[model samples]
Target: MLTYCLNEYPSAHGFENGLRPQLTFICKAEGNEAAIPRVMHKHDERFELMFILAGTGIYNIDGRGYNVKRGDLLLFNAGVLHDENPHTSDDLLIFSCGVEQLKFEGLPLNYLTTRSQAAVMPSGHLYGEIRGIFEQIWQQVMSKKRYGAEIAHHLLSVLLLLCRNIWLENNPEYSSADSLLGQKIKTYIDNHYKDEIALKSITAALNMNQFYLAHVFKAWSGYSPKQYQTRRRIGEAQSLLLSTDLGVTEVANAVGYDNVNNFHRIFHNLVGIPPARYKKFWLTGHIKS
Candidate 1:
């Protein structure tokens, strides 16, 4: 047998001493027959990593859609908006965890990657290793045994390092000046999606011609400005429905809909189900649709 010693190989790159990640929660979802959406939202103080254990879906991250499949890992850095649109195939399984107080050297708070990097990456050859790590974490969390949190903490560090290595190997090269304007528009909308704003307001705030802004934004995001804002509002409405005890009208108004009828129409059109039934399906595991 051959053995290797760590002291024999000094690495030039290593994790910073200040790096400490706190695991907030770990969850696994499977066997959902309906492709219910987890709408556009972001965590301001934590990072979320998800492994698609099976099935395929579309994840909209930072205004673009990624077609993700099994063995794919998705990273949602803090304050980055994302929407989950699962396909209605009934075999989707996902393992996800949330981490707080995470900061990498030279990176923003809770960010594992730069803005240029794609949020979704295929595990490829590392599929087994990555999946095993998630499974271990899930077991620790579910068992609630002694030293479980400590064990999961160490495992999280290893998982993060593996993700960083994968990112380095991928060497993302997607950012450019052309995308900046589109991103700016998205940021503005994200900040004010609940407000009664218009295309003219966006153009005036960003100081771009109305026509030019529309053209560039459509080209970059595959949705017109109005379309993007509508989706954003509807997405938040969906979030409030399932996650909170707010009533339907209250939910509608909270998401910027003054008229509940209009809200119902729009929500039904986009989500393929009304708000009340959507919440009922999630709560009761039965959908009339």
Candidate 2:
């Protein structure tokens, strides 16, 4: 029998601390020329971050392909399906971790993933700075120092804040869109999907006809307004189910569903399994492609 451990970097000292970032260790991975994408895997609501110290690869994440290389950081939020296939010549080495919850400046972390933060970041001084933070985290974990977890958690938070700000500066919304109308509709949905939102209200606010709005949104998203909203709700529910100890009813209500049964039905239809089973798969490490 082979036993694995998330204690690879934990210090050799007995430390006791309660308050810290909700970070979970999945594994620290290194890839080489033989690395090939096998299957897309996900954890219901766990966010995975990879600090690419060395690599040249193409990452297929959530239906998009991103060309990545050394000094790049990749973030996979919640339940996104992702695959990483590196170039035959370039070796890939990374530090990966799972986070159940993270925050910066009172803003939510989900916005980073939704805005396509999975793409490879450009390399430069900031890259080195961020990489240094990753190294510090590794050092603290390996140092066997006092308050090792606390130091690592604080470093990780700073790294996240830097990454989020850089991404925001680099990728400006509403600047580049297939269609302005589509962009507007998407923005509205992304911002208010968790609320008691309606297409009628959106159309009225944008001063656009409901039919035209629906048509353009569908053309861009391949999902109707209601369908897209349902998808968003389910996605949030999955995140909550995995990250928190919330019951099915609580999860449903948190995602804005008044009827728990309806939420379960819709979740099963989209996920091809019941909500409870889906949560169980992640909890038991039985996730699939």
Each candidate's number of clashing pairs is 0, 0
Q: Give the per-residue lDDT digits (tens) of candidate 2, residues 1-289.
A: 9987878765421111322346566344454423523223446566777776776766645434467777777777665645555664445567777776654333344324354333446645687787778778888888879999888888877776677666666754432343556657766875787788788999998998889888877765556777666776787788787789999999999989899999989887766667888877766645443
Give model 1's TM-score versus the native structure. 0.86
lDDT accuracy of residue 37 in candidate 1: 75
Tens-digit lDDT track of model 1 for 47-87? 99999989888787887668889999999999888888777
Report lDDT (CA) for all predictions.
0.86, 0.66
Question: Once superposed on the true structure, which residue ranges of model 1 sit more than 4 Å away at CA?
Answer: 10-15, 195-215, 242-245, 280-289
Superposed by TM-score, candidate 2 places the C-alpha of residue 167 at a distance from the truth, in angstroms, of 0.8
